[model samples]
Target chain A: MKRMKKALERVAETGFFLCAAAAVLALALIVVFLVAKGVPAASKIGLWPFISGTVWQPSAEKFGIAPMIAASLLSTLGAAVAGGLIGLACALLLAEVAPRALAGMMRPLIHLLAGIPSVVYGFFGLMAVVPLITQWFGGTGNSLLAVIVILSAMILPTMVSLAETALRAVPAAYREGSLALGATKMQTMLRVTLPAAKSGVLNAFVLSTGRAIGETMAVILVAGNRAALPSSILDPVRPLTANIALELSYASGLHEEALYLTGVVLLLFIVGINIASHLALRGGKGGR
Target chain B: MRKILDALGYILLWLCGALSIAFLAVILIYVLSRGIPGVNWQFLSTVYKPGLGLTGIRQIIWGTLGIAGLTLAIAVPVGVFAAIYMAEYAKRGRVLTAIRFCVESLAGIPSILYGLFGYTFFVMQCAFGFSLLSSALTLAIMVLPVIIRATEEALFTVPVSYREGSLALGAGKLTTLMRVVLPSAVPGILSAIILSMGRVMGETAAVYYTAGTMAKAPQTVFSSTRSLAVHLYLLVKEGLGAGEAFATATVLIVIIVGLNALASWIARRMSQRFTGGAKT
Candidate 1:
C-alpha cells in the first residue's frame, strides 16, 4: 500500500510539472508559427520596402507599412504622455491625499473601468468622443486625435492602479523623516516620497505604454483605417494593428501573408517594450 | 513662490482625480442612456432573426457564456497545477527562470497575435475550423498566465506551518497540498476565475476569427458562433443597427460590472471571515 501511494505521488508530481511547462510550450508555438508564415512574405517583399514602403496596395503587391508604423508610434507616444501625467496625479490623490473611505470607494470603480470591453470602448468612442472632436476641431471625428483620446482613457485605469501601488510601497519612514526635517506635507510628498518611489512610477509608465501600443479594436473604430501618413492630428491614420485586423478577413494569398508579417512587426514592438519594462523592474529592485 | 507651488500641486491633483471620474461618468451615462431603452424583455429573451430584423441577442449571450465556461474549464486545472509546481516544488534554477519568462511573455503579447495564432494553428493546422473549441483553446492559453500568477500569490500566502503540520501527520506532499494549501487558496483562485471570466466575455479581437461570426446559436462546441462582444462589433461595423449595437454594448458592460462586484465581494467576505475567526 505504501509503495502504491508513493507511485501515485510521483505521478502527480510529473503531471504538475507538465502543467507548469505548458506556458513555455504555448509561447514557443506562437513565435515559431508566426515567424514561419511571415518570413516568406517578408523575404519576397524585401524587409526594407515592407517596413518603409508608404503605399499599401496589395493588388500590385506593394506592401509598405511606413504610415501604419508612424501612426502607431505617434499615438502611443501621445497617449502615454497624456495618460501618464493624469495617472500620476490621480495616484498621488488616492495614495496621499484622499481619505481612506473615499479611496476605497473609488478603487473598485477604477477597476470597473478597466474591465470595460475594448469593443464597447470603440462603440462609445465613435458615438461620444468622435463627435465631440468633430464638433470642436473639425475634420472627420475619426482621426489620430480620437485614437489618442480613446487609448489614453482605456489605459488610465492601469496607469493609476500601478502608480498607486508604487506610491503606497514607499516606506512610511520616508515621509516621517521629511516631516521631522520641517518639510511641509505637500513638499514632503513631492520631494522625499516621490523621489524614493520614482522607479516604481517609471515602471508603471512603461507598462502602461505597452498597453497603449497593444490596443487594437478601439483604435480601429476611431483611427479611420486610412493607410496614409497623417499630415495633421485630425487626419485619419491606420496603425500596424488596425492594418492587420481590417484586412485579415478578406485577405488571401500574398495579402494574407503580408498581414501575418504585420503581426510579426507588432509582436516585435511588444517584445521590445516588455524588455524595457523588465529592465525597469530589475532596476527598481537594485535601487531598493 | 513655495506657497504658490504647493497650491498648484493640490489643484493639479484634484483636477486629475476629477477628470478620471468624469471620464468614467461620461462612458457610463452615455451607454446606459442610449442602451437601457433597447434592452427589453424581447431583446433579452427572444432568438435572433438576422434577415427578418428581429435582433434579439439571446443566442449571442449563450455563446459568450459557453465560451467563458469552456475556456475556464480548460485553463483552471492547468493553471492551478502549474502554480502548485512553482510555489511548492520549484527552486531557484534555470528551468524556473525560463518558465517565469515564458509566463511574462505570454502576459504581454497582444490579443491580436493570439487571434492570428488561433487562426493558423487551431483553425487550420488542427482542423478545428472556426469554432468555439478553437476560440476557447486560444483564450485558455491567454488566461493561463493570469490564473498562474494569482494562484501562486495565494499559495505563497498559505502559512508554512499548515504544510508542516500535515507532513508531520504523515501526509504526503501531494496530499498536504491538496488538503491544506489548496483549501486556503480557494478565495484567491475563485477571484482569479471571475476575473478571467470577465476578460473572456469582453474579448473581441482574439475571438473574432477563432469563433466565426455565425448569428445563430451553436448546436455543438464545434459549431461556429458569435460572442456578444463580437456581435456588438459586427453590428457597429455594419453601421445599420444603431439601437441594437448600443443594447449589445450595454449588455457586455452589465455582465462585466456584475463579475467585478462578485469578485470584490468574495475577496472582502473571505478577509472578514479570516479576521473574525481569528478573534475567537
Candidate 2:
C-alpha cells in the first residue's frame, strides 16, 4: 500500500512539472518561430527599402510596407490623442468628483463596453460610421478618418480603466497637502496628482497605442485597403494588418513571406512598446 | 475665478462620460437592429450559403465552441498549475521575476502576432494545416496569461491558515495544494475560464491564420473549420452576404454578452464565497 501511494505521488508531481514546463515552452516556441521566419524574410528584402518603399505589388514582385506603416502610425496616433484626453478626463471625474452611486453605475458599463467584441465594433463602423464619413468627405466610404474614429471608440475603455486606477492610487495625503496649501482642486490635480500618476497615465497611453496598432477587423473594414499611399485622411488606405488579412489568401511564395514580414514588423513594434512601458514603470517605482 | 473653472471641469467630466456611454449604446443598438431582426431558426440551423436560403451559422457556432473547449482544456490546467507553482512553491527570486515578466509580455503581444506565429509554427511547420487543433493551440497560448494571473490571485488570497492546517494533518505539500488550495480557488479558476471564453468568441485576428476560413464542420480534430468570428469576417469581407452576416453578428454578440455577464457573476460569487468562508 505504501509503495502504491508513493508511485501515485510521483505521477502527480511529474504531471505538474510537465504542465508548467509546457506553458513556458509554448511561449518560447512562438517567439522562436516568428523570429526565424521573419529574419530570413527581412534579410532578403533588406530592412530599409522594404519598409520605406511605396508600392506593394505582389504580382509584379515589388513590395514596400512604408505606406501601410505610415497609415498605421497616423491612425493609431489620431485615436490615441482623441481617446486619451477624453479617457483621462473621465477617469478624473470618476476618481475625484463623481458621487459614489454614479461611480458604481459607470464601472460595469465601462466593463461591458470593453467586453464588446471588435467584430461588433467593425460592423458598427461599416454600417454607420463609414457612410457618415463618405457623406462628409465625399469619397469612398472607407477612409483613414473612419478608421481613426472607430478605433478611438474601441480603445476608450482600456484608457479609462488604466487611467482611473492610476488616479485612485494617488495618495490621498498629496491631495490633502495641496488643498491645505491653498491650492484649488483643479490646481492640485493638474500640478500634484497628475505628475505623481504620470507613470500610470503613460502606461495607459502605451496600452491604448498597442490596441490601436494591432486593431484588425474594424480598420480592415474602414481603411478602404487601396495599397497606395493615402494622399489624405479622406482617401482610402491600407494599414499593415488590413494588408495581411486582405491578401493572405492568394499570396504565393515571396508574397506570403512579405506578408509574414509585415506581421513581424508589427510584432517588433508592439514588443518594443511593452518593454519601454515596463522599464518606464520600473524606473518610476525606483525613483519613489 | 476658481468657481467657474470648477464648473467647467465638472461639465467636461460629465460630457466625457456621456460620450463614452453614447458610443457603447450606438454599437449595441446598431448591431442588434441589423442582426437580431434577421435571426431565424433556419438561419441558425443551416450551413453556409453564398446568397440563399439559410446562412448556416450553426457549424460556425459549433466550431467556435469546440475550439474554445479545446483551448480551455489545454490552457486551464497549465495555467492553474503554474499559478500554484508561483504562489505556493516558487521563491521570490530572479527566476520568478523573469517568469512574471515573460507572462506580462505574453499578455501584451497583439493577437495578430499570435496569428502569425500560429501560421508559421502550428499550421505550416507542424503541418497541422489550418485545422481545429492548430487554432485551439494558438488560443490556448493567447489565454494562458489571463488564467495564470487570475489563478495566482485566487491562490494568494487563500490565507496562510489553510496551509498550516493541512501541514498539521501531516499532508504533503502537493496534497495540500490539490485538496485544500484548489477547492478554495475553484471560483477564480472558473472566472478565468469564462474570461478566456469571451476572448475566444470575439477573437478574429489570431485565429484567422491558424484556422482556415472554411465553412464546414470538422470530421475530426485535425480537420479544418471556420469559427463564428472567422465566419462573420468572411461574410462581411466578401460583401456577397449582408443579411446573413448581420444575423451571424447578432448571434455572436448575444453569446459574447452572455459570457461576459456570466464571468462577472462568477467572479463576484467566488470572491463572496472566499470572504464568507474566511469569516466562518
- Fnat of candidate 2 is 0.58
Which parts of model 2 have CA positions greater than 4 angstroms off? A1-14, B277-280
lDDT of 2 by residue, B1-280 (tens): 8889977877888999888888888888877887887898877887876555546777887788888888899889888887777777667888678678777878887787788888878888899999889998999989999999999999988888998999899987777888998898888889888989999989998878888887777778798888888888878887857887788888888888888889889888877776884632
Off by over 4 Å in 1: B273-280
lDDT of 2 at A116: 77
DockQ of each: 0.85, 0.63
Q: B37, model 2: CA deviation in Å?
A: 1.4
Clashing pairs in 2: B46-B56
TM-score, cand. 1 vs. native: 0.98
The candidates score, on chain A by TM-score, as follows 0.97, 0.94
